[model samples]
Target: MNMRNLIVFSLLSLFMGLFLVLAFSLAGSGGVPQSMGVNNSFGEIKIKRMVAPDFSLDLYDDREIRLSELRGNVVVLDFWSSWCSPCRKEAAVLAEVYLEYRDKGVVFLGISIWDRDEDALAHIEEFDVQYPSGPDSKGEILVEYGVTGIPEKVFIDQRGNKVRKFTGPSTKDELVAILDDMLGSGY
Candidate 1:
């Protein structure tokens, strides 16, 4: 081949090799492939890029509850342990918000992590939590959600998308504001 043709062929080969490397990297990362059609509901759901891992736990009442089952309503998943002081302080605020918004289709599920069921139940009783509370028994929820501390709150939109996350104690006003926004969206 002439020099010009050789140069052109080399450039084309280089471009093709780069494209294949990028494609392989993307495929190995397990990201949504561009070839596969994107789900339109993902955009409508509001939580982009972050997938909420599903889990099931036993409630204090001995009933099994699955996070995926509450997909039609906004959910607040509070991760707490009875030994956490900040969690103790935040329990009442959570309860208040639950009471105010439960009728409006908002659900709060308190999942205790790294604590005994009896102690968690005692704290719930002490804080007067009327909503369903449960034990994370195997720490699966903590690991799935990447929780490194106690009293982490995750807000899931009506479409089962995780829209927001908060670590530490949340005031009543903050909780109320979030609920207001979620309710305003007609969820």
Candidate 2:
């Protein structure tokens, strides 16, 4: 083979070897443990327990939601966009859960990311989302939360610590269980 062709072939082989090593390591490590595993039909969900970053999000309705101000309340921060189908699919689940826990001191805040204000507002109306939702306009809040994809939800405890992150469209049952656990823990 020519020198150029040989160089390309060697690079491809190196990348393939690295990929296989990562795959094996992840498989052998069993990856992060979760109360529920990934359901292929739905999507991948990752669980994380850590301190949540605080931000003051200005909703489209001229209201501001400060994460630090929400101390002593269980908060669910939903990151979504109008163009994402998974976000649309999880809309009802969020609305239903919001209704069920609204009176129970649980707070739900929707952060519309990577979309126009008009589109985000329209999506909220179309989904009939009653919770306080606003556009991430500049995407500052999105970056602060480390959101890599849409339909990711972060659950924060009452003490303003210990956030549980869900990286995909979560089901009603799963949301309920998490909220129940947070509420019952008296944190």
Candidate 3:
């Protein structure tokens, strides 16, 4: 090959190598696959009463549970992580609400995503959370639930229909109001 052509080929190879390294690093970090389209913002997304997707995951205690099995009770599926500051702030509030309404037939499930299992478990324990929680293995459930960010809460009614979603840190009052609405709807 000519000198100029040789130099261009070498540069192209270097760029390709760099791209591969970056791609693999991202994949290793529990990053969602690009085709999943999970990075889309939820700003305009509104929760509607629709059939909740069936998902089964392993809890931190090593037991497998399915969302479908949690029917007949209001389910609060929270997508959060140890690294998310907002999640740390919201965990206590969620715990308090869970304790208050758990006897009233409410089930809270914390789905930790894109984080180490140990860290997730530690955060749950640190916050004194009394909810069924598990890691979203490979982010598959997060993609399915359209979770674009941390601290997202999806509320499902007694009939297993997704009724509402809160995308950020929510106050206790806000959670109470949401619960009241869901209960009033008689779903």
Candidate 4:
């Protein structure tokens, strides 16, 4: 074979080898399966309700909020980060939906994980989010919620039980359906 053809083949072989190594490394580290589990459920609910673990957060507004205090109100816990593209995509939908349900016995709370406070607060402002938001600085909240990635959501019923978890970006309709169900509405 010509020297030019030989060189091309060698380069391609090296690139393929490197790609395989990277892929295998990620898979071996359990990253592949974890990422693959970021389920987007739309409005479907299939999980049985479990009592939500309580948590306290210092909101961006310098106020403290405890999950237990929100009893008797439906809660939506949005787990997101500014660096996550899917989170950014759903920010507007969350903000708009929160407004619609704010006075309907629904409470929307944002938990920013794996992001700087500045970035998280900036994203909140950029999205014009009126809901209370706070940073999960130590990731305790994330661990408790079994969140493996950003853009996950946990819905709580009026009795403070975790009703469902949506693992990726959600739409306005999806949020509405869940909220309606939690509120005992016929929607």
- Shift of residue 17 alpha carbon in model 3, Å: 10
Q: For residues 103-135, what per-residue lDDT tens digits would candidate 4 score against the true structure?
A: 999999999887777778899999999999998
- Candidates in order have lDDT scores of 0.78, 0.80, 0.83, 0.83
For candidate 4, report its TM-score.
0.75
Question: 1, model 4: CA deviation in Å?
Answer: 37
lDDT of 1 at 73: 87
Instruction: Indicate which candidate wins on TM-score.
Output: 3
TM-score between candidate 1 and the true structure: 0.72
Q: Per-prediction TM-score, please?
A: 0.72, 0.73, 0.80, 0.75
lDDT-sorted candidate list, best first: 4, 3, 2, 1
If both were scored by lDDT, which would come out higher, candidate 2 or candidate 3?
A: 3
Report residue 9 deviation for candidate 3 (angstroms): 7.0
Model 3: CA > 4 A from native? 1-44
State the lDDT at 121 in candidate 4: 86
Candidate 4 lDDT: 0.83
Of 1 and 2, which scores higher on TM-score? Answer: 2
Candidate 1, superposed: residue stretches over 4 Å from native: 1-49
